[model samples]
Target chain A: MSISLPKAFNEFDEARQKGFIDVKELKEKGKNIVGTYCVFTPWEIILAADAIPISLCAMSDEPIPEAEKHLPRNLCPLIKSSYGFAITDTCPYFYFSDLIVGETTCDGKKKMYEYMNDIKPVHVMQLPQTTIGDDSYNLWRNEMVVLKERIEKEFNVEITDENLKQAIKARNEERRMLKKFYELGTLCPPPITGLEILKVLYGATFKTDKNEQNQTIDNMIKSVMEEYNNGVRKVSEDAPRILITGCPTGGATEKVIQIIEENGGAVVCFENCTGVKGNDTLVNEDIDPIDALTDKYLNVACSCISPNDNRIELLDRLVDEYKVDGVVDIVLQACHTYNVETYRIKKFLNENKNIPYMSIETDYSKSDIGQLQTRISAFIEML
Target chain B: MSISLPKAFNEFDEARQKGFIDVKELKEKGKNIVGTYCVFTPWEIILAADAIPISLCAMSDEPIPEAEKHLPRNLCPLIKSSYGFAITDTCPYFYFSDLIVGETTCDGKKKMYEYMNDIKPVHVMQLPQTTIGDDSYNLWRNEMVVLKERIEKEFNVEITDENLKQAIKARNEERRMLKKFYELGTLCPPPITGLEILKVLYGATFKTDKNEQNQTIDNMIKSVMEEYNNGVRKVSEDAPRILITGCPTGGATEKVIQIIEENGGAVVCFENCTGVKGNDTLVNEDIDPIDALTDKYLNVACSCISPNDNRIELLDRLVDEYKVDGVVDIVLQACHTYNVETYRIKKFLNENKNIPYMSIETDYSKSDIGQLQTRISAFIEML
Candidate 1:
């Protein structure tokens, strides 16, 4: 069955344009907007400091050529695109950001942050390469405090414990809603289209009003459940269910999702930064916010971490939850962590889950669309 | 003046074969051998544990195809080469090693270590990504101590403070001699060829006895000084003096040195791990051995560290001391840290020192040798 996206949520198509005006209006009203490139940044701290935290990671090829003028062409397209957008003044999020928070996640981003400092004020959190030691947590917690302090000083406001607690609660609530929104994929016929899930999830990041966004998610969930209850079988029950895992995907790499769908597969879940990797865990509200934030952020199973066991655990859960018949790992070109990690992930899924898996390395360019269509078609056929 | 390598110093060329035999003999005596892949490894601990620490990093392309069977092709050639050696059991150093120590310095090597652990007993040291924070140093010191404990447990021997102090003193003595030997390049018409210097340095790493290697370095230094005093000039006075920088180079990358000499340039110094980056700092005898080791190793000025200011400082001093007219930064393919940092290095050299700089990114494959020759020839000609 061919499922078309519902008409109401098409507003996500205009979210980017609307978000631009929202940020401009916020700036005009003397609001501080913080830009982040990785999920490692604890935006709750920024929120408590009375600042708006928005993602600045780019997912397009438009600005990559400008980034390659300084960066190597073989670099991950996401990194190049983000940099290109910053350098070319094309990203509204980057332009409106009063401060940019970065982390020492990988060699590429860590070194790139140095160059980025020349463009804007960049505060880098020294992230440890492994998450298995006491020193790692201690150092990470201290870095979180340092970031909070940096924001405090930047905004000339105090981020009291109460403010932090409130911010944590609100963010945690948003995570639950988003998690619930995406879990609609667990439905056998999958009430929603993969494109709709991605569009709404992406559009949510641009939202400044938390409770309003939460209500929006609440309304969408009810509508999707209602539609499914009223015999709206958007996706066929037998479509090969795929769980997309690896590097972040959205703007350009959305081609992967489109390819999977076009070739008789439903992208039941995203196990990457743009999805569950960013949404799976919530901050511990009872504990100290800094320590809670440290623990939560570090728990993200990024390939940047050595022996990234967390990624395997998450993939294991998502595979079963989504009833995935095949696992499709999407890696950005030159992303060493994810690329090298494909071996272990492939082994784990095959041995433990007994599910067929395929991994594809791609950049943001459209040149590989035909090849991808062919490869994904074969993969779906096997399923 | 065209000078040749002295007959006695030619023994350095045979060092690899001799070192292989030495490792076998040592193994026959039931001695433990600890292999390392980076300069950050605290080898003094291995020495204190009554074990041998030899560098296991591969600098040849012979095993890369075998490694590419499992690892990514677009990775640091050094990483692929090293893994190829380990998996194929082609490297004598790896074969002889009872245990291997690795560091989380870059993404490629860090992830590769996971696969290597499946083959041999590999212990990865979590190296912090930045050198600026107290947490970074604190975490590093803890990691150093952990390494000491791991070595102690592995060898079933006590690495006491006294034993560590003795090992530190011996290593420090060897470092001073090596420093003095390489300083010979400060001479206008360097008495020793770059090839001879590289041979001796690489060979000395395999020596079991520090005093013996120190004596060899001392003997080589005295011979060079004696030859220089007798008016021997191995290089022309007007040959463009070049400083080699960036990734570790030797074995496969010897082609770069050969090309430089074949062209109208003489490499006066190497600022990379194979040269000064590995040999530059001495452990402070006054501090605790573990603390001293951590401090010295952290100060290596590797591109893996963010805002690697130590590199610029070291480059400034070396450029002035070696009277370098140009810098040739040799980057191994897909080594993101060194490759991306090339921008900062080039800017610093051009703006601060008014020196010409060129960078070449090559893999372990000899396919690029002709291209390297052309680019380097043009660079040297301009210089």
Candidate 2:
């Protein structure tokens, strides 16, 4: 039985449809808008500074032609699209932001920030690539302090420790709610579709009110659990449950999910950058707010980090938790970190996990949609 | 006037010609042989344990075919060639090594090391991508300690703090001599060729005795200084002086340097991984030897590091000091970090430094030799 998405998801769709309306309204109320590209950006600090944080990582294939003029065509499509939106004046979020935050996540995006500076005021956070070292924590903690100071100076607002504590509480609540939302995917014949869940998760990045998002997620979880208890399934019980991992697939680029679902594969969980992995861990509430934020953000493992054992561990845990039948590793073309890592991920899954794996290397174009569909269909058939 | 290389350089060449003979002799004498890939590997710790540290980064076009069997054909040729040497049993250095050390400098090499463990005992050091972080220092320091212990255990010897300090002293002496050797290249008409300097630097990686290497460099510096006093010129005084920087170009890969020289561009300095920059800084003896080694190794400025400002600073200083008219940034194909970084390097040189810059992306094969020569010729003519 195919179950319908809860009404709360419709509310999220409406908010996304009215693009940048909330941000524009907030801007009119004199709120500082901070644009960020990665989840590594500390959203709690922006909230503490009484500034609005919006993810500026674009998901459109349209603006790529414009970005190709500035960047090489062989770069990750996500970067190209995001940059394309910036240069073409297509992303309202980019235009509305008072300041844009960038981090040294990867070489392409790191240097791309220099070009981004030409378009907008950019604050770069020098991120350490290894998490095991003491220097990484200290440096990131100092960076968080610097970010706090910069945000305060830029917005002319003092972000006191008390304010940071309150922000941490609010953000941790969101994380808790998100965790509940994803846990519902663990149910057999998962009541909610991956695309529906992805929409809600991606929409949260730009959602203005944390409390409202928490309420919506709470309602959706309740409704999904109710449906699951009623034995209502959005996907067939026998459908191949796949765990999608590698590279962030956000915005309208849900073609991978759409193709998989249409071809008898139910995406039970996404292990990508923009997935639940981004917010699965909570900030230590007992520690200094800055250190808490530093520890939490540093733990979000990206392929950019050396010996990213955390990412692998998370993937392994999710596979077992979600009852995944197969793994679909989708990497955006030219994303060297993820592309090269596919070899190891495939080997690990096949050898240790005893799970079937398929790798799909694609770009932000519909040209490969047919090919992707065929490959994913074949994979699901095997499952 | 045409100038021949000094007699000391010839002697250094003779030492290299007897390839792995010293290592074999040392092995017979019960000396432990350790292999490393990047400069970030703590040679001091290995030296402290009385092991012969040899750089096993290959620079051949031959073994790539063998490596392609294990790795993808489109991966970094440097990694493929290195791994190829291992699988094919062509590199005597790799065969002779009791332990081969690999660092997480790039995704290609990090994953490749896992496969390399099948051929030889591989020890992977998880290198932090950003040096500015406290975590990077702590992790690297811990890694150094671990390496020291591993070497000590492997060799059945104790690596005390005193041994580390003495090793640091000898390594610093080598650094001091290398500094003097490169300073000769800054002369208006450099007496020593770039190829000649690169040979000496590369040869030092496998040279068993630090004192012997230091003595050789000292004699070479004296000979070069004597040539400068006699007004000897290796290339035309009007030749466009160029600085080459990017990935490590070791082994037999002198195509880039040869192309530059043959195209009327005199390469005066290299800001690459295998160049003087890797050893330009000395460990601070005042601090704990481990911390000092940590600080020095963390400062190598590999492209793997995030927020690589040190690399830019090094390039800027070298451009001005070397009196370089042009900069050639050559990256092995699929080496993503340096490839993406070329844009920023180009922009910085053209806008800030007012120097002509050209980026060449090629592989180990000689197929691109003609194209490289044409481009270098054009760049030199423009200069």
Candidate 3:
């Protein structure tokens, strides 16, 4: 599945290098930027407070050596890389962030945030371990207020109801556009390669201009659909459709997807933080904005939530929707929540979804490319 | 540091094998038994429901191969062993349990409980990542009610206030007694070996009779103190006084203690779950039983908390109180919280306490004994 992507996809790809210049200019223009790490972050409040939110570059292996100086070598690469970037001033977005928002997503990331605080001002939201009971609801909802107030106090901006409503509308529209774009996998033969699809999705994080980012995604979807409708199939119908889940995957860990696709599998959908987990659910425009934000953000189904039945539920729907033939979980090394939850996920996919399931656990290091290739190639052969 | 103990310490040693028979007999006699894995479990509720509680035997490597069939290889060995025991019926204590109660204290254990629930009815209480907010208090307090209700319904019994008060009194006495026993480590040129102290502390979990457990602790404390007061110096006064912290260390992981003690170090305190983390705080008898239980259990400084200041505070106090010269943290392999936290713990002790802090990450495998001896021997020499 390889072809030159149209101008729209190229724009999305270049957004990363371009975002640095954009963010620098925005900073010079006195714009407020808040760096984030998880999908659970309520971006609506930051938008309402007139602040730009950046997903701190955490998926790469580049700064991991620096992070291992302060963090343990056995920790998740995402946390270490992110912290490394912060401490080393290696991530331009981090340098540009006026404030950083972190959620209690996992033990590794949460504790790393404590260390990150010395480098930058970090406001952490206490997330509930489960989405059941009144305590879970009130705790999360109150946390929205906490973040909102913190943003208000920090930026000297008032988040009025009108501002919130507009933020909600704009963000919801972007989510809907992204959701429709990713749903291109539902085609019997995907129009674009999985690698291209990932490039667009992963690059969306760096685009500071939300309006341009959404337009690029909308254009990419139309372009891909146009090619597919014209009888152009980049992915073969015989190729096994692979649904990737578990931890966030991009830079170093993307080797798993490359191996899967290279060995006769097309990664049709991603159920982890980088894919539908971030953009699948939309906030209700009718309810109070905070309540809407709380429900939507809490529903993202990170494995940190105990009895995270939502993840199982999402995976089930994803397999059916994408006509997935096999599931490949992209697990980051030392990610306890996802690593442990892999058992339940495997059992569920095996018994209920009737799909062959497999998981690959690797860190940010590229040392295991050969091993991942061997295992993933065999897995794809079986599929 | 080896001496034939009086009948009291001997009774504690026999309790493990003896407990299997006693637990079986109690099961035959139709006594309800509830199994727990952490100190955060509010035992008073189960006691009020007239059920015996046991720490489901988890600190071993024996059953881990069976667990690895379902769980990932790179998980905390404690979770793997516990899950293995439940699935294989290898642990007699697990076999006798009418119910199992697990708290979401850590990701590995919490997710493993979901699978264990399939083997036996398991109740999971959601634990907060922080103890700062009303949500932390209210959520934990409400969970106490939920657990109380679950116990009442499961056993067809009422948990009356009077029942709670009596349970609290009995449990508090046992806690105080155990606290007094472990505090003997504070005595310069300590009377008992660290392994001997661990034996009694770990063995106490198997004793189904709360009264007998408390009395054994009382008697053992009296015996050790009497010998120490009489100028019986088993431990060298010149040895480096060390404090043990981090994950539970008893079975395979206790090799850290052996290597340290074998090399000229006297472990003066254990700040981990198997030691002070279990018995340091007493439930407030004057407050509402649920609130008291919540406050006391929440105060136990597990590394699961976001800002685990309590652990640092406890470690700081323990170093001073134990008159400690060095700190050794026993980290279990893939135990993300403690492993990542080693950085903060090491930084704090160096900056504030002026002590050398080192952490050893091990599993239940004896393969690491040689490595541990080499590393721990060097650490002791540094002290």
The best candidate in terms of lDDT: 1
- lDDT tens string, model 3, A164-237? 98999998888888788888888888877777778778888888787877876776677677778889888899
Best by TM-score: 1
**Would candidate 2 be rated incorrect, acceptable, medium or high by CAPRI criteria?**
acceptable
Where model 3 places Cα greater than 4 Å from the true spot, the runs are A1-4, B1-7
Give the Å shift of residue B289 in candidate 2: 4.8
State candidate 3's TM-score.
0.96
lDDT of 2 at A65: 95
Q: In candidate 1, list every pair of residues with a backbone clash.
A: none
- Tens digits of per-residue lDDT for model 3 on B1-383? 32347556667766778999999999999999999999889889999888998888487898899999988898889999999988999889998888999988888887888789889999999888898877788888889999999999999999999899889999989989888888889888888878788878888888888887776577667767778888888899999999999998786776788889899999889898889997888888998888788888877798888788899889889999999999998888988889888989998999999999998889999998888888888988988
User: On a 0 to 100 scale, what is the lDDT of residue A20 in model 2?
Assistant: 81
Residue A168 shift from truth in candidate 3, angstroms: 1.2
- Residue A102 local lDDT, model 2: 90
What interface RMSD does each of the candidate structures achieve? 0.8, 3.4, 1.2
If both were scored by DockQ, which would come out higher, candidate 2 or candidate 3? 3
Worst-scoring 10-residue span by lDDT in model 2 chain B: B1-10
DockQ of 2: 0.27
lDDT of 2 by residue, A117-184 (tens): 88899998877666875767877888899899999999999999899999889988988998888777
CA deviation > 4 Å runs, candidate 2: A1-17, A65-72, A87-89, A114-128, A131-146, A149-165, A217-234, A282-295, B1-17, B62-74, B84-90, B100-162, B179-184, B187-189, B214-234, B279-295
Error of 3 at A159 (Å): 0.9
